[model samples]
Target chain A: MSVLRKIWTALRGSARELGDAVVDANSIRIFEQEIRDAQAAIDDSKRALTGVMADKMKIDRRLAELNDLIADDEASAVKALEQDNEALALEVAQRIAKREAERKEQFEIAERLASQIASLRQKIDAAEKIIADHQRELSIVRTTESVQKATVQIVDNIAAQDSTLSSARSSLERIKARQQRLDDRLAAGEVLARESGEQALDEKLKAAGIKGEAADANAILARLRARAES
Target chain B: MSLLQDMTLSLANTVFEGHRFDCLPISGEQEVLQVQVSGLEEMPIYVTVTDTQILCISYLFKKSELKEGSINELNALLLELSLPMPLSSFGMVGDRYVIYGALALTATAEHVMKELTTLASNAVDALQTLEPYLK
Candidate 1:
């Protein structure tokens, strides 16, 4: 059966049970098996491709030898005709024709082997892509299982501790409350800092004899003292 | 050690996007890293690493938390809004509705950090948007 059909069956089974751990586990197992099978098939194809390449190489060598033989025979036939030896030239021509036929046959075999190798490579690439896709989907399924299980523990912990993570509404309320508190704290801090900032500025001005009633009184006292000294 | 366990140790001292994470290892069949980002303590994102990918998930709400008649509407709305939500999507793991994001295993630490931050913030936004649907 197809991988998609298997996935569909698994999904339907899971939905029927609504969170059945067994079905989830089985689906994961099936995906793992599928990936393994694809990898094995790719390995086999690679081996077969090696064999096809070897055969093509053998055919190529034979074709090269036949071409050389055909060339030598044609040269001999031409030499015989130049010498006015008709029967010898005809015999040499027949030998060249035989070599040509053998080369043609070998060439056709090499072409078939080349095409077979190409198709095998394409099949390997497609199988590799399918394995990759299946691995990703399996990863997602496993991650979901881990996440749900982890959250189950968290839920149990929440129930045990009786904390605020029981529901979304309560958690949101707590989050809002925390935010509100932080905002209030910031606002209060700003007010206090502003008040103290003003006080510090007042003290600095008085000390500098710049802009305060205390500074005016000090100026009057200084003037009286200076006048007395003069 | 698994990749996530190594990350759990490294991320303890690491801060991303001005937010620090407190990585708590949840021991189970598959070790899950429950990373609680600073300032968003309530919405912790779970990190699980497989050979192929690193997945980050944050629980938005549970099935029981949805209003009696709002599950279908909420699911449809979530599907529509998921497209516009940057770098994250909504899904369900068992009874809990979650917002999640995924990254390749070969992703850099910076990439993982960015994914974690985005997933955490996305969960908060999704929860707030889904407030009307909750009980």
Candidate 2:
């Protein structure tokens, strides 16, 4: 990819990450806002429907008035025709035709408005149902998100505690080994000191007749060797 | 003129300076007039006029208007305010919840207007308290 394309891709990825974070943070608020907005839209749809219906009613009334005017004028036209006043009959017929034409136009407009209002109402109703479903889904996910986050944090804490416990156990073993080594070395030094002290005491005792070697060939050999060396 | 018609004319002459008084279009043994109040938020109140008394009823809301999830809460709120509402108490007509007040036909026009206004006000008040459940 070109450098610009790569940069654009990175920006898109970051934007998605940011969007995910925002959704995670404000999921409930966004859902509530959607509900509010949907309700407002529904209300607007209802108001528009009401206005259109009013217009249709007005048109219907006008059509009714036109019908009455046409009927009266037609009656007058028939009377004039019977009276042999062709000019008056023609004028009345023309007036009735004009009224009829206006009525037809108003009726068509009213029918169109009625249809538009019906279509709009259906669309708004569908939107409300969809928003309601979204709200239900969001509520369920909210609980799941809370519990999921809590459990994840708990797992992380336990993992951290396990590491600390492992180090503590290893430290305990190392300390115990050091203690045992110290104890062993001290024991060996004590044994040597005890043996040397006993030997020195034995020599003193032999000279002073308190402690002495065994009276055997080894003692004679040791005396002869000492005399020879002297 | 009929007793109800006389009562209505007297009512219009006495209390309602500019209120629209139209007879209800029901073929029954009784004469009823619908009183459209002079405010945008107020709904039209219906008065059943008999030989002896006038019962004015104003619609509060429909059972269908009550949200299913908040029905219990709305019912509880209705029960809470059932006894303490001023002038008029909550009543039901089929599936419609209403508020109403009654007066003898012999009652003064002021008394009639008071009862009608009381019913309307109570319905409006109940709607305000139960708005959340309504939505």
DockQ (CA atoms), all models = 0.53, 0.01
Tens-place lDDT digits, model 1, residues A103-212: 88889999999999999999899999989898877655555455556667666554466553567876687678778999999999999999999999988987887969
Measured by TM-score, the strongest candidate is 1
The pairs that clash in candidate 1 are none
Best by DockQ: 1
Following a full C-alpha superposition, what root-mean-square deviation does model 2 have from the true structure? 36.9
Query: CA lDDT of B110 in candidate 2?
Result: 69
TM-score of each: 0.79, 0.33
Please report how far candidate 1 places residue A74 from its true position, in Å: 2.6
Q: What is residue A124's positional error in candidate 2, in angstroms?
A: 1.9
Candidate 2 on A1-230: residue-level lDDT in tens? 23234324533564342112213446457767878888888888888888988988898889888888889998999999999999999999889888888988988998898899889889799878968776655644442233233223322343364431122233234435655777999999999999999988878867875445654556789899999999
Among incorrect, acceptable, medium and high, the docking class of model 2 is incorrect
Report the interface RMSD that candidate 1 achieves against the true structure, in angstroms: 2.5
